[model samples]
Each structure stands twice: as C-alpha cells, then as structure tokens.
Target chain A: MSVVRRSRWSYLSLQQAPLLLAFVMLGITVAAYVLFFDLRLHHLPTAFAWDSTISNALPLVFVAAGQGIVVLTRSLDLSVGGIMDLTNSLAATHMHSSVPSMLLWSLIVLAVGGATGLVNGLLVTVGRLQPIVVTIATMSILQGLAAWVLPQPGGNIPASYTNILANSNSPLGLVFIGVVAVFWLLLRRFRLGIALYAVGNDAEAANALGINVRRIRTSAFVLSGIMSAAAGLFLAAGSSGGDATGGDSYLLASFAAVVLGGVSFFGGRGSVIGVVCGAGVVTLLVSVLFYANVNSFYESFYQGIFLIGAVLLGMVVTSLAQRRARGSLRRSRRRW
Target chain B: MRNSLRGPRSSVLAIRLAVSALVGVLMTAGTIATASASSLAAGKDAHFTIALSNSYIGNTWRIEMENEFKSACKMAPIKTAVNCSIYNANNNVPAQRSQMSDLIASGVNAIVTDAASPTGLNSVVQEACARGILVVSFDNTVTAPCALKVNEDQYQMGYLWAKWLAQKLHGHGNVLMVTGVSGTYVNEQRDAGAQAVWKKYPGIHVVDQLNGQWDSEVAQRVVSAALPSLPKIQGIWCQGGTNGVLKAFQQAGRPLPFTAGEAENGFRQLMASGKVQGYSIGQAPYLSVVALGLAYEILSKHLSAAHFKTYNLPLAPVAVQNSNNVKGKTWFPSLGGDFFADVAQTGTGSTVAGLCLASAKSGTACPSGKLVFSFH
Candidate 1:
C-alpha cells in the first residue's frame, strides 16, 4: 500500500514537472535581475517596473511560444527569422501615418506570416521534405523578399502605432501575452493539441492509434509561422522601424528558450507557459549583463555560459526524475 | 531500423537539393539585374560609365552614402559626362566579389566600392585593375595596391573627440565611454584612438565602456542600464549615437555631460538646444562623392592612378558652438533624426553649395564641381 502511495505521489510530481521547472526559471530570472541591479546600482532599485521588462521580453516570448509548440511536435522552424524580417520590412514600409492604414498593413503582415508558415508546413508534410531544409529555404526566400521590399532601414512608422504596441503603461503587450497563453490552454483541450503531443512522443504509435501524424506536424509549423509573424509585428512596433536583419538574432534565442523552458528536444513534453518563462530568462539575462556593467567583449561569452548552464540544469533534473520514477516502478513491481 | 537510416539520409539530400536550387535562382536573378544595369551605360558613348559597388545598406549611414553618390552623379559635369549605376551586396563579401566581376565583364570604365572588408576584396579589386577598370575604395576600404582609396582619418575622429572631452572635463573627471559595435575594425580603431588620448590624462577616469552598436535605441538602453552603477560622470566619449546617450541622461534626470560623438542630426539638435555640450566629428557621408570624383578623374585620365594612390581626405570636427550657425549649411534642421548632419564635400576644389539635403535625398541636379584630391 505504501509503495503504491509513494508511486502515485511520484507520478503526480512527474506530471507537474514542466510547471515546476518553469516556476524555477522564472524565479531565477527575477533573482538574477534583482541581484544584478543591486550589484550595479549599489542598492535595490526602488519601485521596479514590470512594464519595461514585459515590453522587452514580449517579442522573444511570442517566438518562443510558437517554437515550443513546434518542438512539442518534434519539428523546428528556422524560418522564424525570415518571417520576422518580412513582417518588419513590410510594416515599416507600408504602415505609415494613418491609423486605418496601420491596421490594414498589420493584418497584411500577419497574413503573409501565416502564408509563409503554411508553405513550411506543406513542404515538410505534403512534400515529404525535412523541416530544417524547408524552413531554411523559406527563410532565405523571405530574407530576400525583405531586402527587396526595404533595401535600407529608413522608414517612417506611425508614432501612434508604436505608442500602442510599445507603451509600457498600455498593457497591450501583457494582454497579447495573456491571449497567446490562453490560446495555448484552449489548444491543449482540443484534439489537435493531444494529437501533436502523441505524434511527437511516438509517431509510429500515434499512426497505429489512428492519429494523422502528418497533420499534427504541419499544424505545428503553421502555428510557429503565425507566432513568428506576431513577434515581427511587436518587434517592428518596439523598434519603430524596419530592419531586414533584426530578426536574425532571435533564431538561436528561440531554440535556446525552448530548451531552457524544459521542452524536450525529442518532443512531446513542455508547456507554453514554461516556454514564455524561458524567453523571459533569456531576455533578463541580457539585461543582467548590461546592468552588471560587464565588458561588452565578454557579453556573448557570459550569455553562452548561462545558456549552457540552464540547459544542463534542465537535463539533470529530468534524468533524476526519470531515475527516481524508474526505481519506484521497480519497487512497486517487487511489492506486487 | 531501416526508417532511422533513411530519415537522416533523405533529410541531408533534401537540404542539399534546396540549397542548390536557391543558389541557382539567386545567380539567375543577379545575372539579369547586372545585364540590365550595364545596358543602360552601353548606350552612352561620350559618358564615362561608373558603378558604385556598396557592400552593405543595413544602416542610415550607407543610405546617406549611396544618396550622396546619386546626387553627385546628377550634378552638372557628372550628369552629362558620366553614367553611374549603384549596386548593393547587402553585406555579403562573396556577393560583392561576384558583383565586381560582373561589373568588370560589363566593361565599365571605373568601379567605386565601399568595401565590406579590408582584405576580402583584394583579389577581385586586383582582377578589376588587371582588366583596366579603375577601382576607388572608400569608407570600409580594400587593401589592393592597384585601387585608389578616398577616406578620412578614422583614427583622428576618435582622437579629436577624446582630446575635446578631456579638455572640456579639465583633464580630471569620471567619464563613460560608449563605443560602437564590438570586434568591428572601425570600433577597434576608434577605441585605440581614444585610449591613446585618455592614457595621457591619468586624472580622467573611464568608469565604463559600453558598446552602443552605433545605434540610437541600443545606445539609449545600454547607457540607461550602466547609469545607476556610475558615479557622477562628468564627460561622455561616445563613438556614435550621441543623441541616444543624451536622451538616456535626460531620462535618468542627470545633468548632461560633455559628450562627443558622430554628426547625427538629433545630436546636433540637442547641441543647438543647449541640452548637451559636445562636438560632432562626422565620418562624412559625402566621402562617397569624393570616391566617385576620384573614379571619374581616373577614368577621364585627368589623374594618374599610379600617382594618386592612397588619398586621406581631411577631417572637419564641428564644435557645438557652431551648431546653431551651421544648421542650414553643415546640418539639416528639417531632416529626419538619423540624417548625418555633416554631409558636405570635404575634399578641396569641391563647392559645398551643390551638396544640400534636397539634392542628397532627391538626387536633384546641381552645378558641376571638379574632382581634386589632397593626397596624404
């Protein structure tokens, strides 16, 4: 009886593993931010505002959230950078002074983003192409398109649009984050989401169980495309201009966030919330380095070390849990 | 399992196929663009055909440089005597090399380039020279012996700013040194120049050196982050984004320091408003025009390429005291914030009257000016 009880508790903990990891990452990010701020300022910054932090982390969060979904389905989207660049270029070039035009341009950008995603999905699933290859091709095409649209970085984006998207006090960024999180939660309740998890965990088993593995994989890419487009919009809004190469930096960061969020690279695990927190950690890490007054030359080095450490920590926690669960199963079997 | 081996193999094959296809498409596109551009120059018998091969247009500075070239090409003498075409490589050194080769094949008389690297384009530049095409390299230049170089002393731009900052601070103060992108040649040279000056002034302490990436928004964030840790900075030696550095100080409610940086319009505006005391020593965007003029001179056989090898153009450091007076002349008050305030032709024998904001932006026709170089 005791063995069964202990096994049940272990199973429950295992089920909550992703959530626990996410909280731990969030805690670390906040602690690091405070510690760095104190170390730099020689005192705790009074009345720390979440507004700037939210705005800063929002772009990466959007990308990582989509990336987490794709990773969950055992695929990768290298085209996020291209999608972001395209959206940024388009918005900067077309989203001019008028509020109505801004809205139209925004929709157009998002649609383009979704279309790019659709192409990636189709190539990977229908065309029987590799995800990496498809996304990379699409990324190149999108980057070229972006360069063609805006050869240079100078474009007049409407201040009103920038004000709405980038404003710290506006709550638009937070609301957007909330909406994406809620959407993921809603998705989890759907058949497609469960199918995605099943497909990622074991495609052969999922196929045997009558799930369309191809559709799940395609849907994940499509979702990733849409999310990347959203990230591009926020990035353009925040920067208040178009930069063809701005999105390139987010590519590695998105993958790193997914891993740090405790999302298994092999897929079928991790939550959207965890991914969002993981992005928060990555973004906060940059802020910490800046605040710490670390030499600019060593910034990349420090970031690399922190990222590797986070991934290692996640791996160790996962293996320990697996080992404990396996031991418990053995003990329970013996008792039986 | 059979599935595992096939999966990796097929993926590798797909990647290879996709990359080759993309390369093929890009090559075709490049050929077509080059063909059309060169054809425009083919029709003019009397005009000296010149092409500007710019390696990057990722920043406002490059845009300004290109615009200056366009405006200069439209000017009276060049308008009738030369057919100029601009080709940008989007920061790819290989693409630039290929572009230069195409230009050489197109039979252009001269090729002016703002090279992506000092040594990356040496072979192509040598190839162009061997094909009897005059190549003028500027800004980020090539090290090819055959090419004529037109550049301001970048080292002096940093040295003068540091010297001015040191003088303003009375040789003793805490200073925050905001630099440009890390690992870049320009950044390294600027840092070296500043360090050379700052080392002499042992009293002036450099509290921090942050990389601003030569961008306004980035500089603002970096300076803001470093501000709290800093102890009452009396001077700021910034390589670029002076406006952003000032904005950060304003945001923090700190008194503006004796700042020195590039000739960004916003920085000049701040100087005019007496919000910041500083100097705007610009790496002039009109250096492109100087380079184009050199190409024109060489192509026309007015200047011998052998005699006029490395031409170091003079540097003009604009002080804050002159900011208000030089608004319409040296700087544009009505232009966008990112506009490089110092857009004048720095070389001798070139009149400043023709190089205005309107001509630079819209490529309006201007009176002809002679291409004269003051050699190093």
Candidate 2:
C-alpha cells in the first residue's frame, strides 16, 4: 500500500480539539453510569426510546453553551432567566390561541432577549458599569415582576405543539449544534468578533490598535441577549408549564456553566469548545449523582459547590493561559 | 352586744362591704339564669352580619378556601347580614390592621378576620369585643378575653400525618422534614403534632428539618441543595404543598420523594404516581361557616355557651391518599348550611337530615360553603 499525502481537510478536522474532548468525556461518563450504577437508559418518553436524562440535558447544554458565548466577551446577562420565564409564559399563553402567534412569540422572545442584552451593553459600554453588578440587579428586579405577567403556574401550551417539541428525537439538539456552528463561523468572520477579542484582551491597547473597543463590547452583550432568547424558547418547551419563579435557578447556572467551560471571567482567554464540554461535565455529574441513588435533596447544594469550584478553577487557568499566550508572542517576535 | 363591743366607724365599713357583696352575687346569678333560660328555650332568632378579610390570593389553597367561605356564609340562615366586605391585605400585616379598623369603623355587628401576624391582632380583637361586636377568627387565632376560635386541630393533623407516614415507611427511614412558614402558628402546631407521632416510632429518624416558607421556588432550591447531603434516604416529609419537590424531582428526572401537605395540583399529581408514598391534609376553607353557624347557635341560644368546648371549634383535617380513595369519615358533615339550621332547629346532625344539601357521593355533607358560623 502506498502512503498518500494528507490534505488540508485533515488539519481542519484536528482543529475541533475541544469538541472531540467533550464527546470523549461524555461517552466515558455514560459508559461508567451504565456499567457501575446499573442505570437503564429508559426514562425516555414513549415516542422516543432515548433516556430522559439525555433529553433534559439537550436544553440544559444548549442554554449553558449559549451563555458561554457571552461570558467569552467579558459581560453577563442575568436577564436570560427572565427571558426564559417570559418565553415560557408567552408560549403557553399564545399556543393554538394561534399557531402563527406561537411562532411569532418565539421571535418576540428572542427580540426581548436581545433587547435585554442591548440594555446591558448600553450600561457597560456607555454607562461603564461592571457586568456582574449590573446583571445581578436586573435579575432580582425581573423576578419580582414575573408574577405580574402570570401569577399562577398553570397555562395551556397547546399540548400538541408542546408534545411535538417535547417528544421529538432531539431535533432541537441537532439544530442547537447547527446554530453553534453558524455562530462560531460568524464570530470568526466578522470585524466585531475579532475586535471583541482584542478589546477583551486589553481594551486600552485594542483602542490603540484602532479597534472600536466600545462598539465591539456593546455588540457582545447584544449577541448574548439574542442567544438567550433562543435558549429560553427551547427551555419553555421542555418544562411543560410556566410559572413566575420558573427561571430563578438558571440565573446562577448560566454563569457557572460559562466559567466551567473554560471561559475567562476576567476578560480574555478560554474557548467556546471548552465551555460546551463544561456544560457536558455538569450534566454528566448530576446524572451520575441521580443514578448513584444520592439523596434527591442535596442536588442543589452540590450544583452550587460545583459551580463555585469551577469558577475558581477558571480564574486560575485564565491567569496561566494569559501568561503562556504572552510568552509565545514574545518568542515569535524574537524569531522574526 | 355590738354597741358595747364595736366602734361606730367599724360598723359603717362593715355595712358598706356587705351591701357591695350582695349586689355582685345577684348580678352573677342573673347572668347565669339568662344563659340557662336561653338554652332552655331551644330556639330564638340569632342573627349576625360578618365582615370578612382575606390575606391575599397567594396560593391555590387560599383561593379555594376563600371560595368555600363565600359559599358557606353567603347562604347562612342568619336573619340579617350586611355585605361581608372582602378586603385583601396583600399578605401585609399593617394592611390587614387597617382593614380591620375600617371594618370596625363601618359599624358592622361582627367582624370575622384572619390575621396576617399571629399575635399583633389581639388589640383589634379586643377592640371589636369592646364595641359589643362579636369576634370570631379562622386560620389565624388571637387570644381575647372571651374569643371563640374556628380552625383545624393543627396538632392532631401533624400527629396523624406523621403517624401514617411512619407506618408507611415501616416505622423507620431517613425522612427529611421540610416545614411550612417558619414561625406560623400552623407550622408550630403541625410540627408539634408530627413530633408527637414520631415519639411513638423510635425507629424513624428526622434527618433534616428545613423551612420552605410555603414557597415553591425556595422549596426547590432548599430541597435540591439538601438532597446531596443526605445518606440512605427513603422518603421526604413535606410540611408544605408548594410544588417545589414535584418540580425538583422532575428536573432531576426521578420519581418524586414522599410528601404531604395541601391537596394542590402538584401534590395531587405526585400522589397519583405509584412510586410516591404520601398522604395529603386538607384545611376546611368553609370554616367561617362553621364559626358563624356556631355563633348563631350561641347567640340564638341554641348551643349552651357552657356546653362549648372552651373556644376550640376546629373542623376535621381531611386526609386523602387519592381523590378516588377519599373516604366518608374524612369529610366534614357540619359544613352543610343545613347543619346550622338543624343545630338551630333540632340540635343534632340526625335532626338536620332533611335540611342538608345533597351529599355528594361523600357522606359529610356541607352547606354550599360554611357549616359552623362564628358570631364575631
């Protein structure tokens, strides 16, 4: 057999290192659960034979990954939970009240998400406020108002539409992965994404390098808001019903998932691929805890510890990564 | 002998004391004779107008209770009633206080209110009593000199629930006890009752006692966070029906842990799940009817005030594993508006047979709303 020369496509495939790592980790965890815990992958709804753990993870992973993108740009949006709450309510309220209306509501939810992000961006870029401080306040205020939108927990989501979404064979999952691909491509293509990197790295220096630091930073929050709305729509469909307090927990989880995925909390460093894997890790850990017959009550605390721990680790890694990148840049210049 | 032995001043003091004592004895006998004669008369027209106050439409239980109260008292046979001005305190104590003051100002004959705070309302209760307006309380009880209370036997409810749970768990398990509002009287009585049942079963252990504060979101967070800390847990002891456990379990993609509380949709759904081993406790929302009916009985001179069991007029806390399995004994028969009529007309449930509304397949027939009407 003659050895053939490798093509450029081979190199491109190797570039998806973070995603491959996540998949390998997911497989190992799933295998471990099946082997050690004797858990049957049978919590799946009748229409699909897949396990409910996996089904539930679909929306979770999507939302966390969406949240990861914003964290990369050095801003946070606590209002995503609000977006989820509103989306869930709007979906239930508008469903087969008019089908077209439901689809319109979906877009409107995204618009609301983006609008929330826009507000955050304006605050950060124009008002110049710290992201966490701003987002945290917004989170509290929005939750108080959720009851005004819908006081009771019950609402009709046109069972047929809800059924289709809930029972579908992870079509949303596939679509989510596609959106991630397009987003990744667009970010890599645009001046905004590149300028975001430069600004996140060093705002003053990026401005010196002719990057529109303020505009790019503002755009980051706007994108985060839009993505959150999309995530909310998916989340609303998954939960079956809507309530004022529905999105309360997501506020913290989104931040945790971003930190865990390798996004730097202090601005520049980390990867989107890493954040996706981080979301997977969380999903895996919780699933394992459930399968291990852990007390059902301790899940929340465990999640909290896991999140706070991940954030601390992200901080350490970010410091190290920044140093390594700087060293590499210096060495490259010496060679030149 | 008195002239030789006693001073004139001493004689005068003794005479004054003797006359005062004589008047007091006669007044006391007259009051007793009046109550005795009324009970002897069998029936007199006893009527009262009630001013009702609601806290807020916060939970399903409260909403249903309000509906029950409305139906029970609206049709009460009291000869005269002004409209029961329903005021929502929005769960604020001050707001409730202001509403009570307003009701008092409106010159109502009786004001029946559920206080937001457990103790601060005693002043308002006293004020009503001082005005010769009768004071009847439900849900929230305040201590007053001659106050009559209409509520559930909370201690018994907690005891019964714990006893049943203990039996179901086979006398032993790692059961987490989640409580209702941290400091509410219901929580206190229910907890006392639960502890009483637990005393009998030395094998069962209460691993953790937490406050859910009657909130679903908070419950979910508290329960979710606490689940990992427990070891070898068999079931949960839910002192609330806030939908937190149900939602948390669903999110975890597992069957619900055991629970008990109000018979709300979440708890009801959880019970229907074959894996859930729990029972529910229902509060009689139509309790005002019971109080008012009792009040009518007391004022109309049908029920002997001496026969009243102190101020306790607690109705039964209905227990049900499932709506289909909810048996007759758990239903409150005194709820029928007719029961008030029967007690007014004949004095016993057996005598009120012709007056009761159609008893739904369940035996304890209730009036459209209330059974025992309170006077105040």
**Model 2 lDDT tens row, A1-336:** 011112232332333333344454455445544532343233321222223334344444556665666666666666777666665555655555467877777777778777777787888788888977777776665665555565544355554454444433434454455566567668766887677666767889998999887777777777777766665555555544454545545556666556656566655555565666666565555444433433223345455655554454333333333433444444455555
User: Between which residue pairs do clashes occur in model 1?
Assistant: none
**DockQ values per model:** 0.01, 0.00
Query: How do all models score by TM-score?
Result: 0.50, 0.45
lDDT assessment of candidate 1:
0.74
Model 2: lDDT to the true structure: 0.55
Candidate 1 local lDDT, A1-336, one digit each (tens): 888888887776665576577677678668766765666456663331345556656778998898899999888999998898888878888887887898899889888888888888889989999998989999999988887786655355676876677654445678888888899899999999899889989999999999988888888988898899988887777666666665766788898788778788888988888888888877665555434433223335555665665565565555545555766887678778
**What tens digits encode model 2's per-residue C-alpha lDDT throughout B163-235?**
7778878888877787886435677788998888888889989998878876666778887887767665666
Docking quality (DockQ) of candidate 1: 0.01
Specify the poorest-scoring 10-residue window by lDDT in model 2 chain B: B337-346
